[model samples]
Target: MIADGLNSKVFLAPMAGITDKPMRKLVHSFGAGNIVSEMVAINALSRRNAKTYRIADVRDEPYPVTVQLVGSEPKLFAESAKLVAELGAYSIDINMGCPVKKIVANKSGAYLMTEPKLAADIIKAVKQSIKLPVSVKFRKGWDHKSVNAVEFAKICQDSGADYLTIHGRTKSDMYSGNADWDIIAAVKQAVRIPVVGNGDIDSVYKAKEMIEYTKVDGVMIGRAALGRPWLIAQTHNYLENGLEPEETSITLIKQTMLEHISQLQKYYGEKMALALSRKYVCWYCKNLRNARKFREIYVKINNTEQAIAEIERFFAENGSDIDERS
Candidate 1:
């Protein structure tokens, strides 16, 4: 939704289980770009489902949040868009690029790339249902041979989408190999609306590279943001101004990790947070000294006290070491 209502061009992709409220809040605190909610199922939401309501909640949030909805039915998509609007959503994004097996099997997500008619209908319905700016997130095509992002982007614009986000790989390619920025450039040339490029953008320099190569309006970062909440903020500053990213030390990472765990606890309670923090701890300690040894022991600790202790112990052992991974 960058350049529509957002003040920044950098966007955090709507990653399920990764961009939830706790993670969004953490990234926003660091001045990250537009943050999107995990995909909310419109089919369930149209029935006034309680679980979907909880997933779409952005009420009274200090940072702007875009709600991404996924489903095949146009009426249901429209209804869910209206409902999310009532929940203080800053904007709405329709998910047409998800490549998960179950999602594509349901005729939603990347499957829509093969069925342009339904994709356009869903976009039109959602746009008509709310005043919020609407955007479409899709991929290169249903497969490598069926490249249709250029055509799909045009259809979305014709259907009244305010902007479009195109991932650089086909559904068949999944997340493997290199992202095809060539297809992204093609889509940008094929449309007048602002186009955001997404796929394997993991560093500030790479984000700049994609912009220069694709001539895109903006860049969306996904997997790279894991364990590095300040990436969006850093990328934003680098792009908006001629500024370099600040150095990050091991100590700051530990503090940030602790804060993230605290938020997860506040949101999901102690028990669930304990299980969730395990994976996050691994992400945070990805390449630290003896990280494998730490992770091997950390994932087994089922209690909060032990987890916190392990985090404290790991960082204490490696003080003031800056992240050299990137």
Candidate 2:
């Protein structure tokens, strides 16, 4: 069973290529309840692919770390779940919500919404294969005409999934519109297991509204967290104590960005870190004044020292008007 002792109700969604160790560490430091690893392909994992193994690594993250697995085969899911358990994962999350074209074409991710039997079998197999809590993340349905999240949630619960996370958009929607919290609320009403609501939850008020509107057990934040790791902390504090969050200073934001890059450098080394830092630096500076100019310089940076120098200079010059989005 999933532990009920989580410190907060704010969770960091498992975003591909974005929720790596450095990002997870930064979010966890700011008090996220649980952090999930990027989706690991079961087929690649079974072959012992080095890169896939690294993607599933959670050795240094905080407790209650979850490893999310994506694939269509039950046996492979069972095997991968066992491997994740062996690697010390506290929970296993099945990825049935991804909307990527390649993943859906492979009968994984949101495609499973159209194949409930296989989805249930995969959940059953993983649950029976390990002692860790098993959860599934999925969308409303395959498309507008086939909204089956309520039935899907029931199937997963009956098949032994410990919890469910429902992203309110359908596979066809692909994140183009607002999430339907009412549908999520329906799923919660239909299932006995805990349900987490995810999609477009970018602010503390929205987080609060989701919990109240959907009556979900928790809220998951994905894209909104790209530039603001402290969002989870802000939402958690707001939910716990209804108090307005204190304004974060520009200095603190710059320091956090520096720390984020420094951690990436330490973990991935200077060269690889510079490559990775480019995208993150863009997100961090997305709200700064002269952001376009800053990104132009930052994205072309060839070394860690140069990247760090540019970050410091940019923040020093534009520190007066921090983005209010945080």
RMSD (Cα, Å) for all candidates, in order, is: 1.3, 1.5
User: Ten residues in a row with the worst lDDT in model 1?
Assistant: 317-326
Displacement of residue 113 (Cα, Å) in model 2 is 0.9
lDDT of 2 by residue, 1-326 (tens): 12444556778999998888898889878874678888999989999999998878776565667899999999999999999888768789999999999999999999898999999999999989998888899999989999999999999999998888999999999989999999999999999988889999988899999999889989999998887888888888898888687776777678888998888888889888889888887887776778899999888889778888888888778888665644
Listed per model in order, the count of residue pairs whose N, CA or C atoms clash below 3 Å is 0, 0
- Stretches of candidate 1 above 4 Å error? 320-323
Count backbone overlaps in model 1: 0
How accurate locally is residue 276 in candidate 1, as Cα lDDT from 0 to 100? 90
lDDT of each prediction vs. the true structure? 0.89, 0.87
- Candidate 1 structure quality by residue, lDDT tens digits, 1-326: 35556888899999988788899999999985899899998888877788778889899688889999998999989988999999989999999999999999999999999999999999999988999999999999999789989989999999999999999999998899999999999999999999999999988999999999999999999999998989999999999896898777777688889999999999889999988988888888876777888899988998889889988887777665534756
TM-score of 2: 0.96
Best by lDDT: 1
Measured against the true structure, the TM-scores of the candidates, in listed sequence, are 0.97, 0.96
